[model samples]
Target: MPRIRSLFNPSGKMDKLVFVDSTKYGNHTRRAPRPGLKKGEPALKRQFSRTKYLNDLAGELNSAFRGIWPAKKSDLYQKMLKRFRKEPENRRGLLLMQLKSMEINPRYTFNSLGTCSTTVKELEESVSVGLQVQAHPPRGKYDANTYYYEVILFTWDDPNDTAFWSRQYSDWIRIGKDYPNPVFEFLFPKPSGTTLQWLLCLRVHLGVEDVVFPVLTTTGMQITDVGTFDKDEIRILEQRKQEEEKAKKKAKAAVDDIVRVKAKNQQ
Candidate 1:
């Protein structure tokens, strides 16, 4: 006698999940274009200007760090000081962490884009940004082999509405070991009253696998303080993540909905 196995699982279909941590991927090898000099001018002049700007910024950060670490007497600063002590070798990293704690805005130049390089230009109503994903070899055996990356251009309007992520652009780019880099252009809708900022979101998933969830990676054109994001907005983002997870748990289609949208557009 043998135990009879059920044909279907009582817990329902299992969702396929693949998490790709962008930080683990590290930065791309390709370099941004350097500022060029005319025939008679020397390159050192431009170099000196950049170095001077960096030094000034570093000095400002150092001043702020000193004000908080030793001089300020507070429980929060005391805890931070303990962590800061651990990074005795990495001054720059410690400075960045301090800046984050202080809610300081990061300097975002036109060259902030990662492997997917972009350029920004001013527009009448919306900002225009061009994205070009650079092709590269897969990281490891666990890396996705057959996948389509989705690009969503979004603008946050009403805080109360769950549909704040009104998809301005919905498209997908198929990628693998040999796929070519895809070029995409998006226009984020401008907001009305307050300052309007546009976010470009990239998500990827296996095209052939059913019950699969997407791995999201995002970047934006606007340069603002990290701590400025509202709690309501953060809640909405968390809700979006939950919805994605729920969809995966209940997904029955072989190809994800995003891939279908791209294919439908092609037709």
Candidate 2:
């Protein structure tokens, strides 16, 4: 039987292990995440739960924004393994993964974290669609409040996560749980990042940083009917996106064919 190693040396030789707690940084530096996570704050222990949620959300949003849904919305966002088992390989998996992402959760609704609260601390009823898409000044009820926001409409989130895209790479597959988990990053150049400045500013002004949407932890998550205003917004965005995608694919195909023929002639 063989035993494992414990120490090492500077001369590239073996030596005893040494334990050192090194800061070299500052105090306000983050501590082990206390189930709370904010940008810029450094913590030794990562917010793993948040990590999983963000990864899954990024996967869903990236595809959903691109207008690709494989199964009925109900079956689409389940964990990859569970989703494949219930739906067809062709009709299921990545197709739905993409589709689920493209969807914008309703205003009275939310996905992942929780559902919308019927109450708001403040709003400009002056801007009529009062119950619909308009974002208010702040919620008066709580000392601090966070409102859910989505760029295209009711779905609330920073669009940066949406930018990590699958392009001319036409073939799509479900990000599998068993395989080396693929990390999805949608990079937003410069001020283009949707999650950071704009959304965060609005959320902070509304004092919602301390609040959490109630639906995420609840057992049953419900989907509300898309209202007249919400429906129009969703339809317009989807149509525009579909048109853009078709144009892109057509252009890519033409370039690919030309390149192939030119290579063949050269050969």
The TM-scores, one per candidate, come to: 0.29, 0.19
- Write one digit per residue (lDDT tens) for candidate 1, span 1-267: 954554542332224333322344532233333345342267676556545544543444344434422322234333444444443223232222333322111231112322455554446776566766775324233343444433443333343221123234325444454567777776655565322223343433342232232322121122111111345544655776899988887685544444523566675
lDDT of 2 by residue, 1-267 (tens): 754333541222123332333233211222344333454455423444345544565455435533632222443344433433332322211222323322233231233332222211112221111122223223344433333332122222242233222221111112123323122222122322221111100011122453443432211122222222134444654786899999999999998887433566675
Query: Candidate 2: what lDDT?
Result: 0.31
For all candidates, what are the clash counts? 0, 22
Model 2 misplaced regions, further than 4 Å: 1-78, 91-94, 97-141, 144-148, 152-267
**Scored by CA lDDT, what does every candidate get?**
0.39, 0.31
Report the poorest 10 consecutive residues by lDDT, candidate 2: 195-204
lDDT of 1 at 162: 18
Number of backbone clashes in candidate 1: 0
